[model samples]
Target: MTLDAPHAASRPTTSDELRAIALEQFASVGFAGTSLQQIADAAGFSKSSVLYHFASKEALLQDVITPAIDQLEVMLDRFAGASDPAKGRARFVDDFIDFLLRYRLEVHTFINQGQSLRGIPVIDRAGRLIVRLSETLCDETASTEDRLRLGIALGGAAYTLVAGATFFEDEIAPADEIRTALLTVVTELLAPVTVATGPRTDRNQKA
Candidate 1:
């Protein structure tokens, strides 16, 4: 799941550059497989230099993913008080898709490597956020079917984007196309099911 490295011409600050490199490696090779030395080598910095900017590999990982986690918190808070389930579900689908696209690699890292890195505070926090997200979408009284619908809709979107990126590689569809397809599919999944009534009988006319 390796993405192309950031362009060298962009002059981000040292900490930002290191964070970008670490994120790329973390997403490409699972966090356990990646090392601080590897990130340093890729970024053309010494191990000590990497440490100077980030206290440790864990800290670097935190720096790489903190922004996404922060945004997730904000989105969760906004949807927590949603008074209308139907409208809230629709709004959540829209907002969620945007969030997934905006933080594709970060989501990839969390989805793929989060469990293995569970003891880490940031990873644990991310996991809690995901649970909170599910609760926000479906409350205590939500049906099993509704919960399944929400799970499939949200989980499928994340898997499609993250795994789809690796699967398609160079031939991946454009972002707008992907986003539209996800919205269409997820919206259908979350849509309320309608039961049709049988045709009326003319009791007075035909006996």
Candidate 2:
């Protein structure tokens, strides 16, 4: 949930600070509700300075979320190459938990505001990426139950992290603890169920 510590006290550049502030505002207040001036004020920079770094509010949003989207693309690419479904499922769960934790605010912003911001190129691309992820994770051959399981596992994890942060506030467990718990639950949810291969015996049938 928290960013890694900087090497030095002042290593973060102005742009980096601006993007972080924008991300928090975008997540806390819906994108439609947040203004460039607000971000400028929060970052202690003039509105003109904010504009100098990012052309517009939309551009600033793009700067804030683009890295998360790019990393998602990489995760999808690696998942595609995985030949073992069981292993791949485990790996994907781990990767997804890390992704959600790393980009918690970004995920929160998009999940809550994506529909309203749909026309933006990056938002549209994010939507498509989500669809592709669903498809890649749950293939056509998977049953409805399987698809539902995939949906619940992934969607539940995202919602839990994003919403739980606010819902629990200070009472929430540490990020490492939450990550481990999510990995365990989601991995189990996606795990393949074992079925008996023996001939069926109906209770209604005569022996």
Candidate 3:
């Protein structure tokens, strides 16, 4: 998704131009792989000009991903206040789908390359949010096996969406239809088990 144009002022600041360029570069090569000079060149400014606006590449990355991280925190807070757990989970998924799609590049960076930035506040907050989401899927009372399943389901959905975004870009179905289909699968995956299953017998022993 296209980010909004820089705020209308007499002219856009060098900082704004650098941020836009850094975001694009970060999305392409990730934080560890990008450099200040590359960002400056991309923005048609010298390294000193870029440094005037930001101290270092880390600072640039923090600014790049901060907005997306804050929005996610807000969604988590909103869903936390809900009375129904199931509905809340569904709402979180819908919001998350949109968030992922909108910030796919950032999501891709964090998921695939965030190890380089571990312990950073924003990355840590995102980690905690993911853990909380798994808890939300299956509370402490859930059996270990059930919790494992929920965790895998949640992780799989995220990886699939971020990794397969390109394939879905040229879709045959409408956006809503694709979203509904994914949500249905995730909801079913998280459904509580009501009946125990018996051990399977050999096919040769079947009645």
* TM-score list, all predictions: 0.79, 0.81, 0.69
Candidate 3 residue-wise lDDT, 14-103, digit = tens: 877888889778866777778999999888999999898899887888887888878877887878888987788778777876776677
Give the candidate order by descending lDDT.
Answer: 2, 1, 3
lDDT of 1 by residue, 1-207 (tens): 334455544658888889989988998787999999999999999999999999999998888898999999988777766898667767877887899888878887886677799999989899899888777766665666777787677666666676775677764687789889877887787664542246545679776
Worst 10 residues of 3 by lDDT: 1-10
Cα RMSD (Å) per model?
10.0, 7.3, 7.1
* Candidate 2 local lDDT, residue 116: 94
Give the Cα-based TM-score of candidate 3 against the true structure: 0.69
Top candidate on lDDT is 2
lDDT score, candidate 2: 0.81
Per-residue lDDT of candidate 2, residues 149-198 (tens digit): 77677666766776785677754687788888988888777764543345
TM-score of 2: 0.81
In angstroms, give how far residue 206 of model 3 lies from its true place.
30
* Better structure of 1 and 3 per lDDT: 1
Worst 10 residues of 1 by lDDT: 192-201
Candidate 3: global Cα-lDDT? 0.72
* TM-score between candidate 1 and the true structure: 0.79
